[model samples]
Target: MRSHLLNDLTAEHYRRSVTEGVERVAARLATTERPFTGVTVDALAPRVERIDLDRPLHDTTAALDELEEIYLRDAVYFHHPRYLAHLNCPVVIPAVLGEAVLSAVNSSLDTWDQSAGGTLIERRLIDWTTARIGLGPAADGVFTSGGTQSNLQALLLAREESKPGRAAWEEGASLASLRILASEVSHFSVKKSAKLLGLGQDAVIPVPVDQDKRMRTVALAHELERCRQDGLTPMAVVATAGTTDFGSIDPLPEIAELCARYGVWLHVDAAYGCGLLASVRHRDRLAGIERADSVTVDYHKSFFQPVSSSAVLVRDAATLRHATYHAEYLNPRRMVEERIPNQVDKSLQTTRRFDALKLWLTLRTMGADGIGELFDEVCDLAREGWRLLAADPRFDVVVEPALSTLVFRYIPAAVTGPDRIDRANLYARKALFASGDAVVAGTKVGGRHFLKFTLLNPETTAADIAAVLDLIAGHAEQYLGESLDRAS
Candidate 1:
């Protein structure tokens, strides 16, 4: 038993594994590696040989080799320059190393006893983030799997805060008295969270945006008055720090004021735009985000971390205690009597991963200012890209640059109809994605489809935008121009 526990495979094996893996991947990272990732995935899907059903785990080296081959060969690398599909992109080195250490410890952070040191680390990060947002000095938060979970947690907290001692989870909720206000351009996750929280889809009140996609405050005030007159409870008012479609920042000051008057919880879904808090140049876009009762920020999207690193932060710490369930074995009667804190109190998950380490490591190594500099660089680049797109007569940018997102599409010189602009944008977007040479997002603006570029990559340059625009122009000329005739 002693030999097995302290086996010859102790330090040497661990060192060798990580060393070899890093060495293997380093050359690939260094040379700006390129591979036909999709084709490789298809080829290897049916080609890799697996052990027979009777075989047990064996030859760990063989397993590692197979996995590494698959990773280098088939991985959809978000780091690749031409790999712009979604908000996902390159991850920083410090956080990558943090993931390794956290995995080795394999700590479960539900209770203080389960993760004494980890609790402190997470607490520190939460406190730092909360302070930056100008939340309550006593505000607290927990790492979530991603933005979806963060938004759900925020809404759930708002529910608990609105009606004291009424557990939304245990007693559930009725939609007849519930209404959540948000922009039409808000993340789909808000409506999904409302439905998941038992509020139902119809409970959401989507206020229209002005020419920019920010929520129209005048429209929101009218809706709130209607709800009040109808004797419905206003659950929460959600503001977008950076909307998903066009990256338009909502009128946060106006929204926060409305919420204060109506006594509704103000929640900010800043999953995409939260990093701007670090940017001196662009921080004005999110000026009143700190006034929110809760904020959802995805380190994965904004801070260049791997997926599953995000948080939902509240202005007060005790509201978390309201969401907790006490178990004798975990918290224990003695500990509770002594007033000890547990993470499971605030989080929706049990047996949660030590995801906080990644963000913590990043903050320490890069410094807040370093990350801020990177953020400012990207925002500046996005503006430059937008300017270039707008200058081209063939493409019309839908809105002015707000954050790091750009919405524009191919506009033909001959198109003269009122709806022709939108019609052209829609076709150009569809044609570009159908070929899949590059993937840019698409959505309807003012009841018309508009193409979007979610520029989260700091290394993405004006040339990349030019290339994509060229694709749009070529596709539009081939498909739209001939089909619509000169009248368009």
Candidate 2:
């Protein structure tokens, strides 16, 4: 790792590796011929020499063969289009290459010396993304591991902003009664974040939702007033740009106004839905998103980057400087004199990776509009897929796609009993995913289980959707016949 020896692994290695990996992935994506999961460790040692593993990380050195086999053979790769158990998809080539190059260097990114030019690159990317979200240029942010960390950091910031005088981290939040507000449909991570912040789970208020499952501002105002009467302080309003369950978006403009009126911090958790910022059409869906005190966006989710590329941008850049730690060796006077924006200043991480490089490289190659177009196209494809499913008699479209996710259920006419139909749907969904045959999992809506198709892959088409539907219907028919014959 010496400065002189640094040139040994040099730029040429990264360039060649990037070219090979990207071309391999790009070519493989269309065919769906890649193995679904990694093999066992015991079986993979003979080929262990093929994969990359650094020497500094050696907890698994003894089990390298086993580890490599299991990781390569069993890991559920998000890149595969059929692998839709969660909100993930195939990462584009440029971003993947960006990740590869950064890993080769293994820069810390805590300070200028650690990150070199990465500090500037991350800051600029943050500025670009923040501007799109309607925040001013004064905004600043940092890349994080994923949505959970970003949400936690945002909540921590909200606590600090609301209680500037109180030492919440050390003394653990004062006599002030803190409460967190989020829609009923918001991600569970919101509550988890609040609890982890020492705000307590009881402090999280689950506001009522409209028919579409968006948070009701009227209910929120009532809850705030009720808390006021109870001597509770309204800490922050956690608005969801896209609810995880049905992609329901809490009314952003109205919530923003309510937060402003109450002088509460507005934190938008758009981890799943922030890609709408790229969309000229759906941008209005996230209206007033700009006014948010803080926003959480994951390049991993909407931007089609690999896992662990998340950013939390704030309206005021100085709010980020609040997290700054003045370490002498790290943030020396000379470094400060140079006016470097330490990536650590705005991040919860001490040794952060260069996640921005991917988004930055992706933007440079495809243009921002290209990403937006992908968003719009994926959303529209979800709608078309819904229509195709709804037209068929046996399959039921439970919810029209709110974003790119569609919830559907198979209710064969033979299963006339409501309870029976519910049981059948749940079983079918579980079985399909467990076998990894056209993965569609069950989600509860209105106390009933429905199979979900979260189509983030732009390559996913009507044909793919139709194929999944046929498999589901076939399973439903087979199961239903077995059940009826058993009864007879």
Candidate 3:
């Protein structure tokens, strides 16, 4: 076991292990067809448990063969054209190459000495992102695990920024008086961040949204006024760049004005819409994002990169000190005083992966304009899908999509009641998933079930969406007929 370890002493063994593993993965990618096999946990758990890790196969090929049966075969393939379920995107080739290189090196980006080149690469990427965001000269950011962590860190900064003179580090009393105002349809992470930061869930005040699902500026103003009247401090105004369920972008300019007038920190969660940063045509949709005090961007969501690539950027570089802690063994005070760039000073994680390498390689190979064009393609496809859904009688399509998500419910002519229609839609979605033909998502609006099509794959076309819609209609009709038979 000691000889098999990836230490300097076992360099040859480590090289052989990695080389064989890459070959197997590449072969699997070349052959895989569908997005998912729809294997339930009950069926997969038993088979996976049969693998006896106590007895090492010793041979990489044999180990990979067994691993394929237990894990890879059932894994969801984002590259598949029909995988329109969530925010997952098909990864670019260059990013995959970066993943391979980063994994082999295993560079921990927390310290300067441990990851000398990796730290510089990550900082360069962060600088590039801040420039794209137009965060001005004082902008700074740190790569996070994902959007959730980014949101968490952004809120943490906002909390600290709201309490300037007080010792916030030792006290939870000031946090109780602080409130975070967010759109009702904003990502759930805002509320979760509040809970984790010692601000009770009740501290989150939900601002109403208009019919298009955008944050209503008038409502936000009223809420802020109410907070003032109640002697509560508005710590942060969280605006969604791309909401999860509807893909609606809030009116950022209006929200920004309100935050500015009220002197509250504005944090924009752009996890789903950050790709617009590179968009040639659709970039203006994110107007006034530059006014935000903090912003969250998830590359994995819309930048066609792999998972675990995101960053939280702040307009004021000084705000990042809130997350910094001096460790004697790691990023100590002396190192910082000497002007060393240690990433862990701004990060919540000490053992962070070199995820920025993926985005850097992607930009170099694909070019920012090329990536933007791909994002434009998906947005165009989404509008086309909206037209298709609106023209069809079976779907009660909601308002026109602001981005790449369509939220609608199946409404068969024969189905009269809203309750019955809700049941049919729910059943249809489950049946479609079980059949493994096309994977779509589901959500609820106004307490009624609605099916969703989250189109993040540029390869997916109008015809693909049409086919999935037809499948959904067929399942819904079948469910209705079955329900009628049972009633009779």
Pick by TM-score: which candidate is best?
Answer: 3
Tell me the whole-model lDDT of each prediction, alpha carbons only. 0.78, 0.77, 0.90
Better of 1 and 3 by lDDT: 3
Task: Give the Cα error of residue 197 in candidate 1, in Å.
Answer: 1.3
Give lDDT for model 3: 0.90
**Which segments of model 2 are wrong by more than 4 Å?**
1-31, 34-77, 164-176, 332-338
Error of 2 at 460 (Å): 1.0
RMSD of each: 3.8, 4.5, 1.7
In candidate 1, what are the lDDT values of residues 155-223, reduced to their tens digit? 988876775216444676444578888898899999998888777558898999899878999999999
Error of 2 at 316 (Å): 1.5
- Tell me each candidate's TM-score: 0.88, 0.86, 0.96
Give per-residue CA lDDT, model 2, range 74-102, as digits (tens).
45556665655568867888898788878
Number of clashes in model 1? 1
| Best candidate according to lDDT | 3
